[model samples]
Structure formats: structure tokens, C-alpha cells
Target: MILRMAWRNIWRNKLRSITIMMAVALGLTAGVFASAMINGMMQSRFHEFIENQISHLQLHHPDFVGQQEVYQHTGVPRDQLDRVLENPMVRAATVRTKVHSMIASATYTGGVELMGVLPENEKQTTGFHNNVVEGNYLEKHGTNEILLGSALAEKMRVQVGSRVVLTFQDVDHNMVSAAFLVTGLYETGYTRYDESFALVHMDYLNNQINIGNSFHEMALLLTDIDHIPAMTKELEVMFPGLHVRAWNEVSPEMSVLVEAGDVFAYIFLVIILLGLAFGLLNTMLMAVYERTREIGMMMAIGMNKQRIFALILFETLALSLVGGVFGIVGSWAIVSWVSRVGIDLSAFDDVMKEIGFSPVIYPVLETAFFITLILFVMLTALIASIYPSLRAMRLNPAESAKR
Candidate 1:
């Protein structure tokens, strides 16, 4: 009976009911769309970091992380790494010998970390070859070939085929200098990583340091990202003396951005709901005020205060549901369309790229958020209806009927 009455009451005042309903729907639309776009942006950023910079897991001599010396490298070679790749979970792994050094051209010298990498293995692990803008990736046994980040190349004022001399310490802590031809230039879109690092054939550095097959780092890329924790655990057990870490462990700030992004998305949802609540509260309160006499008549006829209160609350809920449905439908349409084409913020490209971010973002929301939205709107209606429901319940039957 209450449901039937609530339905009839809302339509009797279609314009007013619809206005509040639209408000609710629009509020939810804004909230949902905002969440999806931000979610997409963060997800993109996370993947970019994993693919370009960190891969999935890194292994090194336990002291290598602390000492950061060329001598602290691992003695394991490519074959040792391939043995682990036999595991189904391990997709690809690459060895790198890192040395902190100054890369100098005739005109400029910049402090950089020289990363010695096996071309094929590094290509499989990092996909760095795909990112090359000029020239080609390092060739196997291509004597003194160097792949440089475009920003790093630019900073040193050199381009492809330019010879750059790298000076760094040998295994014995004695300084060794070598000249490498710029075989490739890569732009990772991550300016910091690009400007601070350079790549060369692992054998070149190993030969220079006189340590055959010695490496400072081993990076493992997985078949699936979800395998990170399990793989990290397995690798830790497999290589006891080596330091094994997942990308998140290596870069906590990126981890924090990913984890905290959801929190911020929900906070935005709440703020939108709260703003919509005020409009709902006013509409419900007015409905209660105008129906005072009718409510009293219902009470006088035989309805109890509980039923009367419920009827008023039900009407408000019905109104909110109408808005919530429209909002969900509209948001779904917009998100679906926008997700494919993406919202291009190319206008803000300069600002965005400056901070190592992409301007184009595709908004994406989880399925759970839609369910949560309906519940949130219902909750808002429940809270908004409280004062109005109480007011109806307080109406004096005889006096209200007379009024």
C-alpha cells in the first residue's frame, strides 16, 4: 500500500519530482565519469612505469643496492638467467651492469648511469627497442654500441652516430674510459629516467671491467603482472644471496599513487553525493510540509504513525531512484563512448609532459562502483527523508485535517 501510494504521489507532482531526480542523476554522472577518467590515467601511469622503467622484478647482489659499485656485480651470466626462465611464470629476464659515470661530448659533459645490457634480453625485458625514435637498438657484439635516451642525448648535445666517451671505475676501482657510437636514441616519455641513464652492450662493460659474465642487476618481466608477488617470493628462494624486489618495492611512491588513487576517486564520489543530498533534502521537506493535512487525514482514517512515516520516506526513495537510474544510464553511455576515443587533453600537453604524464586519458570505472552508486543514492535518500518523515509523523491529526 505504501509503495503504491508513493508511486502515485510522485507522479502527481511530476515536474518537482523530475527536477530532483535529474539533479541526483546529474550528480552521479559527474561522479562516475570523473572516477573513470582518473582511474584510467593512473592505470596508464602504472603500466608505463612497469613496462618502461622497472619491468616486474629486479635481482642483484644483496650489497649491490647499498654499495652501487661496479665491483659489487653478480657473477651470473645470461645462461644462468635463462635457467630461471624455464619456469612458466618467468617470462623474460635481462642482466645489466651499472656504473655511475660522466658521459662527455666535445661541448658538454653530464653525470649519468651507464647501463650495460644484452641487446636481445634487454629488448625482451624492457621493450626499449620499440621506443627508439632514431637509429636502431644495440646490435649483438656490435663493439661499443650505445642506446641513449633522447633527453640524455639532447642534454649532451649529440645525436645518432656521434661518439660519446664514458668514464667510470673498473672492478678494481680504477678509472676506465671507453668511447661508444650512438647506435639508437630512445624517448621513454619519462624525462627523469631518460635524462639520467644510457645503455650499452653488456659484454662491452664486462670486458672493460675484466669480469666475464658479471652483472650488477637482473630484471625479470613476468607473463602476467599478477604473478609479481609469487614470482618475487620464488626468485628470492631461488637466489638466496641476491636482492629480489618487485616494482612496487623498488618505487614506493608509484605504489602509493596507485593505491591512494582509488581513495581519491571515492572521496570525489562522496562529495558529489553530499552536494546532491542538499537538493534532495529540500524537495523532500517541502513535500512533507505540503502533505501535512493529507497525512493527518490518513492517520485519522486509521493509518499509524510508522506507516505514515514510511510512506513519506518511500516517496523520497522512489524519487531518488528515478534520478539514480537516469544518472547510471547516462554515465554509462558517456563513459563507454569516451573510453574508446579517449578525452584528449592535448591542449595541456606541455604542462602534462613536463611532469612525466600523458595528456590523453581514458576514463574507466570498476563494475563495483555502479553498484555502489545506487546504494549511495539510496543512502542519501534515506538520510534526506529522515527529517521530513519525522515531520509527517508529528502532524496532529485533528488540527492538520482542519488546516
Candidate 2:
């Protein structure tokens, strides 16, 4: 009975009721779309770093990971790596010899972390070969070949086929200098990475450093990212002496950003809903004030205060649910269309690239998010109805009927 009365009473002031509903609808639509945009940007950056740089997990010499000393190698044997590769969860694995060195061209000299990698294995692990923007990926059998970042290439005033010298300390604390031919220029759209790293053949580097069959880092990509925790544990047991770390452990800041992004999104949504709640409160308050006489007459005719309160609560819920339905559907449609087309922020390409983000973003939202949002809207309606429902419940039958 209360539900029926609540629904009917809403239409008695159709224009006012619709005005509040549209306000709620529009507010929710804007809020949801904004959350989707934030989530898309964060997801893009996460994938970019994971797929193109760090892989899912990495194994490193404990000393090497801490100090990055050229002499601190993993010292794992070939058979150990073979066992790791045999794991079904590991999609690809590659060893890398990394060292800090000075790279010089005719026009410039700068510091870079030189990564010596096996061409084929590295390609499977990091897919960096696809980032080659000019020239070609290092030949599988290529010797003394180097891949430079496009930004570094430009800074060095060097081009493909240019000669560059790398000077670094080798094992036994000896400084060694070697020349490499720039075979390719790659751009990963991460300014810091582009400017800070270069690539060469792992065999050649091991020969220079005199670390026969030893590498500093072993990076692994998993068949499924969800298996990271289990795989990390397996690898830890497999190489008890080495430090095994998941992508989150390797990049704690990015992990923090991911968690913080979710919190920020929810906070932003709460703020939007809080604003709409005020509008809802005011609208319901006006409705209750105008219905005082009607409410009193109902009480005189045997409608209890509990029923009166329920009627107001039900009316507020009806308004919220009607608006919420429209809002969710409209946001879903817009999000779907825009996600397919993408939102282009090309105008801020340089800034985006500098921060390691893609200029184009595809919005995404999980179905769970919509479900939670609906519950939040209902909660907001319940809170907003409290004062109005209490006011209606407190009306004196004789006094209100006289007015």
C-alpha cells in the first residue's frame, strides 16, 4: 500500500519529480564516465610497462639487484635455466647482462644502462623488437650490434649505422671500452627509459666482462598474469640463492599508483553523489512539506506513522532508482561507443609520452562497478529520505488537517 501511494504521489508533481530525476541521471552519467577514463589510463600504463619492459617476474642476483655491480652475476648454470623454462606457466624467459656505461657518438656523450640480451629470447620476453622505429632489430647472429632509443639517438646526433663507443668497468675492476654499430632506433614512448637505456648482444657483453655463461638478470613472462604469485614461489625455490620478484615488487611505485587510482576513483564518485544527495534532500523536503495536510488526513483515517514514514522512504527510493536506471544505461552506451573509438589526447602527446602514458585511451568499466554504483545510489536515497520521512511521520493529525 505504501509503495503504491508513493508511486502515485510522485506523478502528482510530475514536473518537479522529473526535474530531480534528470539531475540525478546527469550527475551519475558524468561521474561514471570520469571513473572509466581514470581506470583506462592506469591500465594502459600498467600494461605498457609490464608487457614492454619488466615482464611478469624477474630473477636477479641479490647483490646485483642491490648494487648493480658488474662483477655480481647470477652464476646460475644452463641446466637451471632449462628447468625454469620447462615450467608450463612460463611463456618466455630471457637472461640479460646489465651495466651502467658511458655511450658516446661524434656529437654527444651520455650515461646509459646497457642491456645485453639474446635477440630471439629477448624478443619473445619483451617484444622490444616491435618498437624499432627505424632500421632493423639486431640480427640473431649479429656481432657488435646496438639498438639505441630514438630520443637518445637524436640527443647523440647519431643515426642508424652510426658508430658509438661504450665505456664501462668489467669484472676484476678493469675499465673496458668497446665500439658498436647502431643497427636500429627504437621508441617505447617512455622518455626516461628511452634516454636511459641501450641494448646489445649478451654474448658479446659476457665476453667483454669475462663472465663466461653468467648473466645478471633473468626476466620471465607468464602465460597468464594471474599465475605470478605461484610462479614467484616456484622460482624462489628453484633459485634459492637468487632474489625472485614479481612485477609489483620490482616496481613498487606503479603498484602504489594502481591502488591509489582505485581509491581516488571511489572518492571522486562519492563527492559527486554527495552533491546530488543534497538536491535529493531538498526535493524530498519540499514534497513532504506540501503533503503535510494529506499526511495528517491519512493518519486520521488510520494510516500509522510507520506507514507514513515508509511511504516517504519509498518515494525517495523510487526517484533514485528511476534516475539511476537512466544514468547507468546512458553511461554504458557512451562508454561503449567511446571505448571503441577511443579518446584522443594527441594534443598532449609530448606530456603523455614523457610520463609513459599513451595519448589514446579506451575507457573500461567492470560490471561489478555498476552493481556497486547502484547500491551506492540506493544508500544515498536512504540517507536523503531520513529527515523528510521523519518530518512526515511527526505530523499531528488534527493540526495538519486544519492547515
Residue by residue across 1-403, what tens digits does model 1's lDDT show? Answer: 8999989998888899888888888988998998897799899888888876788899988888877987787776657887778889988888888889998999888799998888888778878898899998887584899989888888889999899999988999899999999989997777777888899888888888877777888888889999988998888787787899888888899999998889888988989888877887888788878887888899999999999889988998998898899999999999999999998888987576666677888888878889988898899889988988998899899999997
Among the numbered candidates, top TM-score falls to 2
TM-score of 2: 0.97
Residue 345 CA displacement from its true place in model 1, Å: 2.1
lDDT of 1 at 358: 74
Whole-model lDDT, model 2: 0.91
Model 2: per-residue Cα lDDT over 13-45, one tens digit each = 999999989988999999999999989889989
The TM-score measured for candidate 1 stands at 0.95
Which residue runs of candidate 2 sit more than 4 Å off their true CA positions? 140-142
Cα-based lDDT for every prediction: 0.86, 0.91
